[model samples]
Target: MKVLITGKGGQLATELIKVFPNKFDVVALSSHELDIVDAESVERSIAAVKPAIVINAAAYTAVDKAEDNQQRAFDVNYLGCENLAHACKAAGCSLIHVSTDFVFDGKKATPYFVDDVPNPINVYGASKLRGERGITNVLEDAVVIRTAWVYSGTGNNFVKTMLSLMQNKPELSVICDQIGTPTWANGLAQFILHIASKYGEGERQSLVPKPVTYHWTDAGVASWYDFAVAIRDLGIEKGILKQAIPINPIPASQYPLPAERPSFSVLDKTETEGSTGFKTTHWRHQLDKMLDEYTEDSKLSEGKT
Candidate 1:
């Protein structure tokens, strides 16, 4: 099966290239190679690749910056998605769009379900929600997988940020009130490949249902402060960090940004679980695995030096 993935160097896209099933002839395109914002470019690229499936991992992901760059965000997030949907429709291929949990306002104390009404609190969220709508509007068999708090062993992410900060500062403060699950890119890549494989076999439509919008995250929820503390503790345990720094828990008000965030963005996976029969590992466990791999890589590099 030929699978074309956008955002080649992104955390999720990188993992998909490295770990996706061997049977797939994956054509991973960087933003420079195939800019989705250009409708003609997308159509041309899709036509040339003639892929069985297009996994759209490309997105405008700067949460705070999207507030000021709404035009760029909409162009990439909303209009870009619409372009991809049209391209897929034209090519007779399926699309698996990676969305976010930010589509919800996070007003509910419980987890956000698939059928729950979306009320994005910021420009980024609104843009992503619009992208989701655009995909479904154009293509009936598109899979919009809404995920949150993605990180990985490679690339810039929350884990890397926390590790760098802890190395430089003796103490750090992180937002404690805001809550969500952290999803590892490797796991998400696997899940996406599974869906793609099913789609290639023409079995996913019966299993996933039409206009599929699924929620995916790690097994447990945590506030930013809690997540940071875990990174600090786990890094030390795995020899990925030299010191255990004190991480202070602070409210979101203490560290205000241009964009307003959803205080509680936990997504429910009941529908996804029922549909795919796929279970995710806990956040802490995933964190440990990533750190372990990081530690191994560091050791090998050091030995080479």
Candidate 2:
């Protein structure tokens, strides 16, 4: 199968390329290489590549920055997706769009299900929601997967930020009230590949009889404080950090940003699990795996030096 992936250098995109099966022909493009926001460029690229499926990993992910730059956010997250959907339709191919858990207002005490109505509380979330709507409106069979708290060894994510802070600072403060599950980009990448393979093999009906949204994240939930604690402990154990530091738990009000985040953005993955026949791993466990990879890579780099 010929697969085209956007946002080639991103955490999720990098993982997708790393874990992709050798049987598939993958064409991964960075934003500079294939600007998704440009409708004409998207159409031309899809026509030239003629991929069997276009997996859109491109997105404007700056949550707080989106508040100040709504136009750029919508151009990338919303219109970029619309362009991809239209281009995919023209090319007679399918689309697999990655979305986010922020679409929910975080009012629900429990997990947000696939069919739950979205009420985004921030510009970033609202833009992503609009992108999701654009995809479904343009293409009937496109797959939309919403994930949360994603991190990988290669990107600027919560895990890396926490690790860096733990090494440099004597203390850190993290929000304890906001809760959600962390998703490893590697795991999410594998799940996406599974869906693409199924679709490419003419097993789309088994996965999705119609257009659907799926929620996927690591199995367990935790607050930012819990996540930071785990990162601190794990970093020390893996020799990624020299010592432990005090991590203080704080409410969101104590440290405010331009964006209003969902207090409880956990997503329910029951349908995704059943459809893909893949079991979800716990967030801490997935973190350990990623740290292991990071540790090994760090050692290799040191050796090279």
Candidate 3:
């Protein structure tokens, strides 16, 4: 099956491109290749690719910035998804729209389930929720995967930021109140491909269901402070960092941002695991895997030089 992936340069898109070609005819497009917000552009791209599966990974991800850039956020997150859904429908292709855990306000103590009522607390979350609605409204069969706290070897994310900050600063402050699972982009990419494969097999058998939403994250949970401390310790153990960096846990109020975040947004993946018949790696293990990979790649590069 031919697969069309948007947001080529993103962390998840990059991982998808790396793995997709092994199983499918992949057509990956960056923002330069396709402007998802423009209906004409989306239509033309889908028509040209004629993919059996269209994965819309592009999104406006600036959580804090979205507060001041509501229009742009809505344009890209909401309208862009609507356009992609319509294009996929016209092209008779299934869609895999990536969403976020931010859709929920995070007041619940337990992990969020797929059917939980979403009451987004910030503009970014609201826009993403709107995007989810737009896609489902247009294409009921689209698979919408809501993930959280994503990080990868190559990306602007918590892991990368913490590593950099630890190297330069003696002490770093992280919010202890905010909690969620840290999903590895590569792992999430693999899950998406697995779903696509299941969908393909379902074309011939009753293996996969049509147009469902799922929450995926690395198993287990951690606050920002926990994540940073782990990153620091793991970086040192893996030789990614030269020295230990002290991490100070502070409340969210200590460090103010333009946008408010859910205090707890961990997603329950039991249903997703049951559906796929495979369990996801724990977030700590995922972190170790990425850190190990990063270390090996860096050593290999240094050796070549």
- Supply candidate 3's per-residue lDDT for 116: 98
Candidate 1 residue spans exceeding 4 A from truth: 301-305
Clash count of each predicted structure: 0, 0, 1
Q: What is the lDDT of residue 178 in candidate 3?
A: 96
Q: Model 1 Cα displacement at 282 (Å)?
A: 0.5
Order by lDDT, highest first: 2, 1, 3
lDDT of 1 by residue, 79-149 (tens): 99999999999999989999999999999999999999999999999999999999999999899999999
Question: Which 10-residue span in candidate 2 carries the lowest summed lDDT?
Answer: 205-214
| Reference-based TM-score, model 3 | 0.96
User: Which structure among the candidates has the greatest lDDT?
Assistant: 2
| Descending-TM-score candidate ranking | 2, 1, 3
Better of 1 and 3 by TM-score: 1
Cα lDDT for residue 89, model 1?
97
Model 2: colliding residue pairs: none
Better of 1 and 2 by TM-score: 2
Candidate 2 per-residue lDDT, tens place, 134-212, comes to 9999998999999999999887999999998888898999999999999999999988988898987889877777788
